[model samples]
Target: MNKDFHYFGTYSAAILAGHSHEDALRIARSAFFVDLCTQPVLNSVGAPIEAATTMLAMEMADARSDIISQQDVTRTWASFHFLPYDLYSERKGCGKKYMQKYRLICKPNGDLLVDTVTQVKGKSLEATGLAMHVLADTWAHQNFAGTPSRVINDTNYHFFEILPDGSERRISLRPNPASPDDLIKGLFTGTMRQGKETSVMNLGHGRAGHLPDYSCMRYRYLPAWADYEEVIKDNPSDFMHAYCQMIYAMKYLKGEGGTFEKATYDTETVAPYKEKIEAIFEKRQTDDSEDWKAFGESLSGQEIPDFDTPDYLEEYHKAPEDKKDDTPMGRFILAALAQKSMVTNRVYKSGNILLGISGDYKDWGTKGIRAYLKLAKEVRKGGVI
Candidate 1:
């Protein structure tokens, strides 16, 4: 989902879950930063540099150093939860089936999400926020896969546009077999990216772009090779469902419940928060704004300190070494790496790939945990990883 769910909606859920306003804001910020923490840059002397601020600066930077592995941890966490199409399905010659497993709303794979969240509940608020990101996407990205597949996502050359009044009219989509550059262009121009026959970095939502993540968007498509079409209506139920799940998960995390019992969508449990949620959406729409910082501040009922500024770093530098994990940045980094081993081994590579099983899966988790701890220690020393 968009920041509407990731930042604002998550904050609301934390509040509803009985967290203090300050704790709720931190959880929301961590949720949003999961997407923002992709870049890992190196300084002039080849020292790894952390993103001082959580704001987007152009496109995400590539992983370059051991220090950059922190970014990889976050990226990997995101891939498991959001870009989950990497796991192969059991069906033969049906890569699309693998992709469909993560589409929770209209598919049978939501149990995987619920189980994953249940295992990770009470680990930490940061971890819970990470799981929430994945849970929210199961609804917003119901039909799309995390991996790039031409047959599953590629649409025909036909074009359609949704007018201001919610009516659609035919418009020009970009030429067929759209290149990566063409796909980028189509994102800005509101034109569809026609799919290519071959697979070549045509990853998730490249054909549809970010429309699937927009809460206000409704789209329909007929795959060039498919017999039927898929229609996605603009609905808020997905957001409502996410909010309800967050509440339920929080209860389990708080030890109030032993297990997470999935609630029916739009049930009475979430009905009370519907008006508040609608008001948040209405204010966002009326303002036509995507300023997450301002929106988060409004939800937090306080002004947040800018972590990118030097003053924040000065305070960070002065904090006691043993108390580092209690600091905001330290807590975020620790939580990012905390569950890497479990997710990679148990969730991503649990004999789920296209190929058959190989070695002991527990070994994979062991190796991953070792690597994360080594790199995290290096980052704490001097950000040299």
Candidate 2:
């Protein structure tokens, strides 16, 4: 989902779960940082640096160690992006099966979240936040498999023009699916990236981009190659369900529950937060704002620390390895790395369930965790990876 859910919505949910404002902010910030921590860099002077922005920059420097590459960075980022799709169902090449597993739609038999929360029980708050992200996604991202497939998301384009008075005029589009030209023409928003034919890397809802992640967006689109039309009218309900799950999860983390029973999204629980979330969405749309960093800062009520800053780096270096887990940055990194590991084991590794491919990637999770830890050590010792 977008920052609306990852940051603001999560913040609201934390409050609803009875967390203090400060703790709620911390939870929300760590959850949101999952999307922002993609850029792992080594500076010109060969010092590992924190991310300056959320934008992906995968290029590696020649002066840096040759062990890591752009592909490694890309895979790492993919681990984060595909976390919600981590389903070890042992079903290969079935998009619907994967979606059902990923989204926890067919419950009792299909829900993996009960097991997921149980495993991470009594873990750090950062881990809870990470789990919450994957949990929340099961609702907003229902029906879309984590892997890309044209069969899941192929679409024809039709444009709409917004007038000065805030009305829309539809513009019809008719391009051959086989040889479409200038696909960007008359498209007002979303990325222009196209996926390769028959590849798992092909994205669902590429036409709508991140629109599906927004709580207030209600859209219907007919996939050119699919049997059924895709719809997202009840996203508010989905968000509400997600909020309830977050509350359940927090309680689970506190040892108040053995299993997460989905909470009732009644008016008393959902109304106040819904109003604020809807207002944020409306303001963003009206302003045409893409400034999620600024928006996140405003919701957080403070400046997020720049990890590259000396004070932050010094604190990280001085912490004992065992005690590091108690620090905020340490917890964040540990949770982020742990989430990446789950994705590697549950999603990317072939033959578990969902999509299967042949390879020896079982150690990917271990390798990635080791890599991050190594980077942490290097940073502590005044070096870079």
Candidate 3:
């Protein structure tokens, strides 16, 4: 068999199986990253940049992948908790707690690689999804630091002040999985508010209020919904882009944004998913301008944009209140549509999407192979076009 003939199948089949192109790409990209870290491969600065593009491209694909149902999203989110520590680990300085949270390792080079820890303690799926989000953030930070960097401090996590009416409103960062963007509000330009009911900050904070020594670190808990809306007001385009990606990604696979028929576990699910699919079929005879136009445009493909900006990213700032409810589906649709151009442009710039899979990489070609396979699946499933 020819070495190049490693893959054999129709792209559509992959899609029907319910996997996204981006997920496939990420598996491949991850393989390449692993190889580079393991093998003594020489590389240029362009290599890492290209690798970064592949990472984001796969993410875009995942963000747009089809969701057959909200349950699917929930299950997938849960499954992430099982991801092995070795797959995405990094070392931290010194602490005995949260050891399973992640692992520490040394690369072939002197750079320390912190692996992403995805398992949720006590087998909680909701906790797992939250864990994945935190891990994504941690990976983003570690990747940027690139070498001999700590992923988290065993004793360190974020703290937020829930008292909005009192003087105790504040959010604290301890440097482990600590991102300035996470700590501060870019748009509000002041301290972040911790919502009374839903604290977005707490989603990342993990083990909070439970800490016996709560006063050890100060916390300002902002209203989750308010902060969410404020995020939109502060940067309508960016918030729209972010939420759009999440919604559309769920919708692409499930045929509706995966909000549930009713709220379960205190969260919204996709009644919209079922309704939108029905509406699409029901409205079929009545002139299909909006969706048809969008579908037609999607064939061209484009890339999703990054939402974090310098201001929102700065330490200890808040976003404005008006940003939450602006232009719902439109934002997501535009972001997903951008994939066509982004992928194509990057491919043209480099010879292939596997720009990061270079230097002493032979077997690791599977990384690229798997990525394309994932892409083919997504495209065929109608989650991506």
Candidate 4:
């Protein structure tokens, strides 16, 4: 697979510059490494120091992560709940529609030590730190392919509850949640949340466009696991102004006969129409599509096409009271509970008592090895060319 150009060059140089693998890791943990996430800069001679730094970091991470037993890391990576697409997009980050939960791997041992994979939208520093952790974990695990001595973060932490009766209770918390969905939601909620932007829909709507804009924005939010508020801190009025201008300009583009060269208006200019702008995006994919068409055809074949609206709209629209059972959230909760029980059962079977628990739990050898292989295979042959 192709590697990131900038990351390749810098990492090669670091190795040649008498830096050990450990030193390279430490360097990556620095603030300077975080800066490489943006565009590259040049030194006095224009050697592309910034590019080199990124290249080095990537190489370092990849090379170290490669130390694993060379099983199919790519395949396992693909099965991850995250990275919904083959390549994680930068232009369109995570938007309102999609959210992900992540695992935190500890360094040196590549142990999945931490349950809370903290992520802050709009907070570059925090995101950078998380990225560094991910890279470090990847490297350590790849390098050390043997069975992990212990599961990462298998110890218990203290949890507390504040009751309405004005008393507090301390409870022991397991390292990871019992249910997969709950674990996923817990990791998601613990690591990410609604920020000043308040809603993903708002981020998708932008100032003017709908579905496409929302989709684009979603790409950005997804990869970074960002908070909209943090991104807008530097330009509080950016979304508002951008939305108004896009709408005004769109009118002219769509033959509305509006002036294309109007003077810039303040954020207040779009306030009245913001709600409408948001609506357009929410319904972007409402139009007929192949996916809907295929489903409609299938429903017809099954003799279940009795509906006022087309079969295409049936899935999107809500069913009647008797038809509607579990909301998406409810289904998610049930799944999470089931996963928790399974994991708990596995713990019991392992006979390795959890740190907080009085009993024992079993050792699930590095199943992550397969996951990593899957993830690596996702890297295209040409490497995002």
Candidate 5:
């Protein structure tokens, strides 16, 4: 999901789940920062490069598709963005090699989702926010893997958008990442296809374009891994579920529920506002930040401030080194480190070397690997990611 869902929509869910306005902003901001907290962004903010939870487009585009780079990409993208639901998920008659990529396909309610939420229980709001981002994505990014694999991630011309009237509109895609999807003309923009089996072009939903990012979109397309079968993505439904589930998960984080579980939603709490929420989803727009921000304000009787990526940069820079980790940005960095560690450890434990081996930093240690060692020091100190 984009900032609309990860930021404002998350704030809406947190408010509905009983978080105070101040607390909700922290959660929502951290959720959005999962995308913004990249190496370049963190460097500019004067943060340790080890704290970046994502990669900039230039970094990703220039990254090699070799095995080592693939592992690095998987560590960042899989941990933060397209979190794999189950590392051991199976496909009938599939061999071990193909299963590696298959296991990375994201779906909601998997064990990793449970680990993601429960790990942050009673932790910082930033951790809760980071978990919310991963949880919301399981709904939006379902059926896609985090790693680069052409056979598993490629798409053909069999794309169609399911309109509100239950009709289908054929989608014509062109390679133009500079512009947004032209829904009015049924034209979309996506990455140009690359024949290389592990090109970054084949990663995530790039092949499907931003259709998966917009909550108002629902489409039918043939997945490269689905053996020519058609899968219909009812995004309004999925996005709605994501919002409700975020509330449920947030409630658990707020000490309401006993434990966080998959497939549960706080539909009861959101029922009264369901109509308005549905309206936002049914509007068929590329972005819904304004609608979500308005609703969040209504929920708490306070303005939902614009998300400034560097909002906490000054705090980090001015604080004493010993107290730097006490700032919101510091907490966010720690949470990012923790979440990435937990997910990477899980991937390694599941016997999928596609993301490489996971080991204790105490036992081993990168900008190449030294930078990773430095990050591991944070995780070792905190006792998680």
Candidate 6:
């Protein structure tokens, strides 16, 4: 959900849940890192390519449509950005191929979300961040699949923004990649509809654009998967759910709470700031990063630093080989690999091979053997998957 929620909002949630400033920043940094930890960054840092959590624009352009490339895309995007609610959703009168993509549609309070959050219990701060990032996106990315599929991820619905005074403003959009989303005038930008069933335009929420990322937006449209039924996206409510759930998750991770269950939120912790937090969400703006940052700083009395990609990443690159795993980026890398492996395994076990089959990363014969071994360590120690 961009830096607003991924970085600043996450830090605020962590602090509200009783984490120290340092710990909150570490968790928020790892959560935001899911978007920036691309293959190019991995290459510069000499990190294992398999630990790559996100793909850069160039990487997306270079990716071929082969099964191997598809597997890589599904693994990263599905596990990290769009955690599926169910893999065995009923899809009658559809071919087996269509059902695979349909079943990957994301929804909030999914079983997978519970498993992911619980998987990071007693794990590193980096692991908590990764899980939080995934948790928050479940609200923002609902109804979109992680993989590329025109029928599955395409958004051709008529868009409207729900105004504060109970009015509906029909929003205009241009399918121009170069133009930014004009949030002030309520104009948006999205990917052009593609004819190819597997075109990249249909990946995740591209066709829907940044509307999902903005916290202030509440809109209505006919979802492709809803069979002409209208669906209202109440961002204030959904984003609030995400924030509260994150607090509950962090408390659980820190051993201050009970079991991590679906549909549960830590409302008591956020009760004091409910009005202020809701105000920020209801403020119509393209970028709410500044607002969230200000809120977090006010709560902590400590300045929330801007997101710097090289902070922890370069430290991992410069550290001695034997001591790298102790570094922030190294720890994050291990967590990423393990999380990816676990999610991939779950998808396969649930009878869906759309993300490809999962296997033991601990296989010593693998090309990136060190990454695999460390992945095994995180899995075994954390009891994740």
Top candidate when judged by lDDT against the true structure: 6
Compute the lDDT for candidate 5. Answer: 0.84
The C-alpha local distance difference test score for the whole of candidate 4 amounts to 0.24
- How many pairs of residues collide in model 2? 5
For every model shown, the clashing-pair count is: 3, 5, 58, 63, 5, 0
What is residue 70's positional error in candidate 5, in angstroms? 1.2
| lDDT digits (tens) for residues 1-385 of candidate 1 | 6565777667767766777777776677667666655433212212123321121323322323242433333334334444343343344454544434332112213555666577555456766776667667666665554433455555554545454467775533433444322222223222234343223223344465555555544456654223465454443555556667777776667676666665533245557546755554434231212443454455557664433423323444566866655655455555555434334444434444321122333243334334355334634454332
Model 6 global lDDT (CA atoms, 0 to 1): 0.86
Clashes of 5: 5
Model 6: CA > 4 A from native: 360-370, 380-385
For candidate 5, list the clashing residue pairs, or say none: 338-385, 366-369, 366-370, 366-371, 367-371
The local distance difference test score of model 3 is: 0.23
Over 101-200, each residue of candidate 5 has an lDDT whose tens digit, in order, gives 9888878888988999998887899899999999899899888888888887788889888888889878877888777776777778887899988888
lDDT at residue 195 of model 2 (Cα atoms): 54
Query: How do all the candidates rank in terms of lDDT, highest first?
Result: 6, 5, 1, 2, 4, 3
Candidate 2 Cα errors over 4 Å, as ranges: 39-110, 158-187, 193-195, 198-201, 223-226, 262-268, 271-323, 348-369, 372-385
Between prediction 2 and prediction 3, the one with superior lDDT is 2
TM-score of model 5 (CA atoms): 0.94
RMSD versus native structure for model 1: 7.4
Give TM-scores for every candidate, taking all chains together and pairing residue i with residue i. Answer: 0.67, 0.62, 0.19, 0.16, 0.94, 0.95
Task: Check candidate 1 and list the clashing pairs.
Answer: 66-385, 67-385, 148-203
Query: For candidate 4, lDDT tens digit of each residue in 152-210?
Result: 11111222323324454432222232422121112211111223222211121111111
Q: On lDDT, who's better, 5 or 6?
A: 6
Report how far residue 54 has shifted in candidate 1, in Å: 12
Query: Which candidate achieves the best TM-score against the true structure?
Result: 6
